[model samples]
Target: MPGESVEYVVVHPDTPVGPVVGLFLLARSLEDAEEIGATVCGRALRTRAELSGFLLLGCEGRLVGPYFDRLLGWAPAGRVMPRPDHDSGNPFLDF
Candidate 1:
């Protein structure tokens, strides 16, 4: 029971929207996470709270801006996948 860890709910991407389901926030920099979001076609989402981080995005050309606009108001998506080079435990990523 000691030193136990929890796993996030994992979902594999299927439909174009599938990537949105398993989004997560990085404990690190918004800048680094935003770069990854841009890679997946999502823009960085900012909030009154600590930077909400990256979002899971589909092609904006395919979906209406209003849909994403409203979604962003709610969940404010995070990184869809952690970068392989990222050190999840170290927020500063010093290691």
Candidate 2:
């Protein structure tokens, strides 16, 4: 019926424990569904897992590891220094 739109009725009346239990059950079901989906798409899941791990491990340092420094538009602290443009007319000399 058009009048039957989703509505909340307080069945518990007092402390409302039922709705809290229902929410926890719903969360568990969603977690299980994601796990099942991951198992079904294992190869694609591995790609995501590796990417997630790379992101976590790659940024664990205070210095911000090399993998992400370029992405953030900041150069990593010195190993091979980039010469100032005025010092070396050839840009390739930075390497």
Candidate 3:
């Protein structure tokens, strides 16, 4: 479990065919995750030019927009991982 990672997926559901989603990769470091997220965002944009308006990659503590030229890092709000220890607002709760 030491090698495990956390993933955050962003999706847009306004596509003509269907919803388009971009995933924030989980790797060694947050920097690496940003790199991978950027790549996924690029691919999503390339796949559908219209998806530009619905793209956002979760980086650090804030969501990374596609227009960003640099990656920003911030303190995580403990909303990482999908396990019981990582509390990202109770998944079973409904507002």
Model 2: per-residue lDDT, tens digit, 1-95? 13222112122324533211011111134445344333333433366654343211110102234764456464455323443464566444434
Error of 2 at 29 (Å): 0.1
Comparison by TM-score, 2 against 3, better one: 3
What would the TM-score be for candidate 2 when compared with the true structure? 0.17
RMSD of each: 15.9, 23.9, 10.2
Error of 3 at 88 (Å): 26
Ranking by lDDT: 3, 1, 2
After superposing candidate 2, which stretches have Cα over 4 Å from the reference? 1-28, 43-95
Q: CA lDDT, every prediction?
A: 0.37, 0.32, 0.52
After best superposition, candidate 3 residue 48: deviation in angstroms?
1.9
TM-score to true structure, per model: 0.20, 0.17, 0.35
**Clashing residue pairs in candidate 2 (N, C-alpha, C atoms within 3 angstroms):** none
Give the winner by lDDT: 1 or 2: 1
Give me the overall lDDT of model 1.
Answer: 0.37
